[model samples]
Target: MCLAVPGKIISIHDDGSLMKMGQVRFGGIVKEVNLAYVPSVQVGEYVIVHVGFAISILNEEEAQKVFSYLQEIADEGGQ
Candidate 1:
């Protein structure tokens, strides 16, 4: 099964004609995403990213909680 991970919208850069490029951040890992489906996203907002597109928006606290959980899992695995 595929998963749409939650990430924070850190920046946006339109090409003056289309909403097709921007940056999203997940735990300091940044990636390019398609804004074609989500043309209204802004910085400081959380979004559910899937296959280079943002499918849905998430809350700030919820995003942080996800990161916290991942950190915990990584810590456990390292032990």
Candidate 2:
């Protein structure tokens, strides 16, 4: 199954084009994500990431809920 995970944007890098990139933190893991889809995004914002792309911006409360659910799944060895 495919999953879109919630992560916080830590830093942003403008490539001088439409394709913007940033480092997103998922719990303790950080990965580069494409931010072009959400041009209004900024550092410290929460986003739903899938396949290295930030699909949508989410509020902090919603982000935390998803994180908690993922943690529960991990704790249950459901990965």
Candidate 3:
């Protein structure tokens, strides 16, 4: 199954191209993600990322809920 994860945007890079990119932190890992889909996204905002792309912007509360669900899945998998 394909999954999209919620992450916090830490920084953005404007390399003069139409494809906007940013550093997104998920749990403890940070990865570069394409922000083209969320053109209005800014630093400190949360985004839903899938395969190195930010597909949507969401509020912090919603982001936290997704994180909690992921943690539950992780905990269950370890048992």
Candidate 4:
């Protein structure tokens, strides 16, 4: 199954081709993600990313819930 990860957008900029791009932080990792799908998203907002693209915006509460679920999964695997 494909998994969409939740992350906070750190910064955004045009890629010179007018495409919106951003740096997103997931836990301790950060990655560049395409933000064309979320035209109204801003830095400090949480977004659900799938395959390098930010697919949707999420509130901080919702984002925290997802992080909890991910942590549960990771904890399960570590045991």
Q: Over all chains combined, what TM-score does candidate 4 have? A: 0.69
Model 4, range 9-67, lDDT digits (tens) per residue?
Answer: 99999765647899999999999999999988999999999999999999767547865
Candidate 2: give the clashing pairs.
Answer: none
lDDT of prediction 1? 0.82
Clash pairs (backbone) in predicted model 3: none
Task: Supply every candidate's count of residue pairs whose N, Cα or C atoms clash at under 3 angstroms.
Answer: 0, 0, 0, 0
Give per-residue CA lDDT, model 1, range 1-79, as digits (tens). Answer: 4688888888888886665677898997999987777777888887888888888777667647865997899999999
lDDT accuracy of residue 43 in candidate 1 = 85
Instruction: Point out where model 4 deviates above 4 Å.
Output: 15-18, 61-79
Q: What are the models' TM-scores? A: 0.65, 0.71, 0.71, 0.69
User: Which stretches of model 2 miss by more than 4 angstroms?
Assistant: 61-79
The true-versus-predicted C-alpha distance at residue 31 of model 2, in Å, is 0.2
Cα lDDT, all candidates: 0.82, 0.91, 0.90, 0.90
List, residue by residue over 1-79, the lDDT tens digit for candidate 2. Answer: 4699999999999986978999999999999999999899989999999998999999767547865996888889964
Per-residue C-alpha lDDT of model 3 across residues 1-79, encoded as one tens digit per residue: 3699999999999776778899999999999999988988999999999988999998767647865997899999999
Task: Please identify model 1 stretches exceeding 4 Å from their true place.
Answer: 59-79
